[model samples]
Target: MNPEIYSLFDEPHADNEYTYRHNIGVGIIATYLGMKLGLSKENLSALTLAAMLHDVGKTRISDNIVEKPGKLNEAEYEDMKRHAIYGYELLKNIPGIPPSIALTALQHHEREDGQGYPQGKSGKDINLHAKIVAIADVFHAMSSSSGYAVL
Candidate 1:
């Protein structure tokens, strides 16, 4: 993991605190897991960066929707699901970022069982880095301390 890339969110922004903490946790966990899985240095770096910014699109979401204390209404849930594609669109054209990183952001919510959002990719169709980020994201979101906890 590149220190500078990770350091980008080191100074918390008051409004983005939830996003900052959640993405940081996902990044740390994904980096450790990537190392454990023997990913190459370059792959691990991409994974770390992708994990850190996987939810960058959430910044575009209305705070009322993102910070809702209870369940999102049906329409809000559908709107929220667009974050993956929004993140992908935000990242795809950026110079220097690996294509895998952008793909990871696009596909992180895709499930192995074909029950996910945006593209509904499943099984081998999903990128490896995206799968890793998805697991890490869920782990962080489900942790008791995370404000995004659903269960």
Candidate 2:
């Protein structure tokens, strides 16, 4: 891995271990799924990177919101959702970060049914990498033992 990329995964975060592990797990699973779906090598690499950093915006969230143990109230839930936009802003201008990678952060929360957040973009409007990450993110959260309040 390039040092620049390594530094991204290595960046210190005040969040708990579960969030880190979830990112790793989602990266692996999303890459595997993408490969099975016949994504090219370049796309697979992008998918892995994007999926791993899908929740990178969470680092910018308040500890109280990010680490909240139980269900969040309406206001907090709305606040928690901003992590997607925050993640996009954080990665969009990085020298080596591709547009797709930055976009994955912004669109991963969007859904096929057009009921997603931030932009509420539907189906084709959301990037493919983001869609894959969304699936992987949810899968990792649901499969893990940790109590993820939301994805």
Candidate 3:
């Protein structure tokens, strides 16, 4: 892993661990699915990297909101939703990072039904890589034994 990428996981904040594990698990699952789907090596690598960093924006959000034990009020939830765009902004200026990769961070929260936040993109408006990362992210969050059951 690149030093910069590795640094993202160096500090394991109690609240952020769920986000970290969720992103990593998405990468792993996407890689496996990419192989099964016969994706090219370059494509697979891009998807994996995108998946791993999809929630990097959450690093900028408040732990009080992210790790809250109870349901979030509407305003709080909206604030929490901004992480996707925030993550994209953080990755956008990084030298050599592809636009597609940055977009995954921004678009993973998007739903097929156009109900997602940060951008209400629907169907083909969402990039294919983002779609793949979204599927992997959902799968990991649902299948894991962690307390993300309420998500």
Candidate 4:
């Protein structure tokens, strides 16, 4: 594997180790979930890459919003949510990137109940890989933030 590919993750703020860790953790978990869901090996590989880069758009966000220690105000939160669209644009522009990868970046925040942001896509409207990455992302975020072993 090319180390250059991984170096992209390091492009984000070095002080935000949690974001880096979250990306890697979600990648592993999402790939595992994909495998368990009977994805082909090619699909699993794409899932791993997609999950790791799912939050790449956060780089486009301001440090004030992304690194804030307190809850965001309504306007700030709206701006923060643009990271999804940013991520999609970033990945989709890269030559040879898979459609699933860009879609996952854009749609991972989507919910089955259609309450998610960037787009109100619900249920089947969301890509399967995006759905799996969403679950893995939440699990990892909760476990890492709470220091608990999720069952």
Candidate 5:
């Protein structure tokens, strides 16, 4: 794992072990997808970094908000939507970070049909790396009990 990614996991605010593990799972899935797509080493690295830190901005949210046992109100949902931009802000200044990684923070919420958050970007408007990360993120979140548990 990249040192930067490891440092993200070590953050005090990232105490939700479920989210951290989910992020790592997404990164691993994205990495494999990138390799299968025949992405260059540099591209693979960038995608991996993007997947790893995709949820880093969640650190700014309170544990109560992230760990709510029930559904969130509209206001709370709006706050949750800001995490992607917050993630971009957190990763943008890191030295040696690829633009693709930062872009993932902005574009990962986008959907193929344009039914997503932050930006309602659709189809090719989103980068390939971001798309891959988004798919992996949703996959992990849906499959993990602590992520999107359907009660």
Candidate 6:
């Protein structure tokens, strides 16, 4: 993780609008995707914000595991999966951010088949922002050469 990303998790007072700093491609793709989906400008902003900060909970994870070069052990994987909930916990109380934004962080890992972590909310239970973020996150990860790419 970048030192700045670490500060994002460690420093609560730091800026939360980290899309421009962390994943500009994801932001652009998410916005474009949202526009394609016919989302309004206000909805687009919410979608962009949710996509950018979706992984902010990674700060709660251990650096040793986060920076590990090899694939993680089962325990490490499980621990890392808690980032979704950590992100929700981190953002839920912030005064300015929307509740949907926090839900986006919480449910981005959730799947339609109830296979996702933290919660198994399937189908309609999942929020739209989370579903959009999931798609954008996957698109960015696969297209980029970063270590996060799994497919």
Colliding residue pairs in candidate 4: none
Q: Cα RMSDs of all predictions?
A: 3.1, 1.7, 2.3, 3.4, 2.7, 5.6
Candidate 6 lDDT at 6 equals 29
RMSD of candidate 4 to the truth, in angstroms, is 3.4
* Range of the 10 consecutive residues with the lowest summed lDDT in candidate 1: 5-14
lDDT of 6 by residue, 1-151 (tens): 2223323443421343332334556667878888999998888987887777777777788777765667999999888888889989987877665677789889988888988867889999999888887888787777656556421
Task: Give one digit per residue, the lDDT tens place, for model 2 in 14-47.
Answer: 2467777887889999999999999999889989
Please give the lDDT score for candidate 4: 0.82
lDDT string for model 1 (1-151, tens) is: 3344443344323366776777778999999999999999988988888888787766567778877887898999988887788778877877766887778878999999998878888999999999999999888888836457521
Tens-place lDDT digits, model 3, residues 10-65:
43243466666776788899889888889888888878888888877877778888
Q: Please list all clashing residue pairs in model 3, or write none if there are none.
A: none
- Point out the worst 10-residue segment of candidate 2 by lDDT: 6-15
- Supply candidate 4's per-residue lDDT for 106: 96
How close to the true structure is residue 119 of candidate 1, measured as C-alpha lDDT? Answer: 84
lDDT at 140, model 5: 81
Candidate 6 lDDT trough over 10 residues, lowest sum: 12-21
> Which is better, 2 or 4, measured by TM-score?
2
> How does each model score on TM-score?
0.87, 0.92, 0.87, 0.90, 0.88, 0.82
Question: Candidate 2 regions off by >4 Å?
Answer: 1-3, 11-15
| lDDT (CA) per prediction | 0.78, 0.83, 0.78, 0.82, 0.79, 0.72
Task: Give the top-scoring candidate (TM-score).
Answer: 2
Error of 5 at 64 (Å): 1.5
Report model 2's TM-score to 2 decimal places.
Answer: 0.92
Better of 3 and 6 by lDDT: 3
Off by over 4 Å in 1: 1-14
Q: Write the per-residue lDDT of candidate 5 for residues 1-151, one digit (tens) a residue.
A: 3356557655524566776687789999999999999999988988888888887777777777778877988888888778888888887777777888778987888889999878899998888998999889888878777647311
